[model samples]
Target: MRSIISFLTMIMLSGCGDGVTLYPAKGTILLENGNPVTQGTIECESVDNPKKLNASASIQKDGSFELETMGNKGIVAGRHKVTLIGPAGNSDLPLNKQPKPQFNTKYRSYDTSDLTITISPNATNNLNLKVVPAK
Candidate 1:
């Protein structure tokens, strides 16, 4: 009976399903203060539709980020947009006429700004972005 229960547990675990894990892309971004900007948000969208394949990640205090996709069960491997939004100050407030806030601006509470990127599928994408103060 113990052996049978063990076998059932194994089967159940194996049938959990496929899942995809995402890691930080290669590259670094330098901020105006000369500090390596590591904390930010990353959004992924489908290349064909430019609306599908939505994914996001928030940089940890240690300057690293990790995001997971639902897996390719329905999403096809291809090019996608990976937008990076960094924290910005109160200057990113929403406009009176704008119903929905824009990228990066939405993170104003945390002081983040938008930084869009393009990435291909089936492989890890390494990206670095440099942000300069608005002169």
Candidate 2:
């Protein structure tokens, strides 16, 4: 009886580690003229419950990016709305006062007004977004 109880306890503890992991979702942004965009900011938000999850990352000089939110500080395992705010190139503006710039590749303003994504526990996931130029 004692051995059986101990075995069951171990099994239960193992199940507690279920969670999602995401990879370095990297991609490039370009202007409508076919020029590579070298500056911007990317952010992730939850679609189901907007206030539940949020994450962001800064674009690199080569137009590549990677974002990670893990160890209980990352997004929960589920769907999310991904949004990108291109760079305005204004260094004097306050952080809170800056507006989200539009992507200039395909002429679209943002990546997804209602983008959906899923996060799996104890795993790594990668995603890419190509933003178009604003009309």
Candidate 3:
């Protein structure tokens, strides 16, 4: 069981002095072709309770990210619906110079994404997830 509880967008932090330590979850995001996803945000939402505060992270240039819950970086012990939204690409560019969507709409939300992740009470959870572009 997780020591933390999340409701709506509110996060409550707790811990067990009995010895179970909850650690943060980290992962790397990559395109199906094995290239790094330069910019974007990743989400990890509780499966049973969609309203629970969702854990989110900024996708780094190396395609890596760490999930944050209750102000700390980690999720409670349970299943999570993972979602990734790639940056619109070249956001720094002029409006007309922005690039098209790098991935399909399905990759943008937990409800539509096929990605699911499980978090444990381990010291570290490093998931290597992959995303693909749709035709």
Cα lDDT computed for each candidate against the true fold: 0.48, 0.56, 0.73
Backbone clashes in model 3, listed as residue pairs: none
Question: Candidate 1, residues 72-94: lDDT per residue as tens digits?
Answer: 21233455555556553354566
**Over the stretch 1-135, how does candidate 3's per-residue lDDT look in tens digits?**
243333422432343223333468888988889987777788887775445557888888898898886566677667888877666566579988875555567977777899988887754688898888645
Candidate 1 lDDT? 0.48
RMSD of 2: 8.8
RMSD of each: 8.8, 8.8, 7.7
Residue-level lDDT of model 2, residues 18-110, one tens digit each, is 343333344555555665556676666655543455666677766666654532234555666666666664578888877555563322222
Candidates, ranked, TM-score = 3, 2, 1
User: Candidate 3 clash total?
Assistant: 0
Residue 68: error of model 3 in Å? Answer: 0.8
**CA deviation > 4 Å runs, candidate 1:** 1-27, 32-34, 38-40, 49-51, 71-78, 82-114, 121-123, 133-135
Question: Backbone clashes in each candidate structure, one number apiece?
Answer: 7, 13, 0
Predicted structure with the largest lDDT when compared to the true one:
3
- For candidate 3, report its TM-score: 0.72
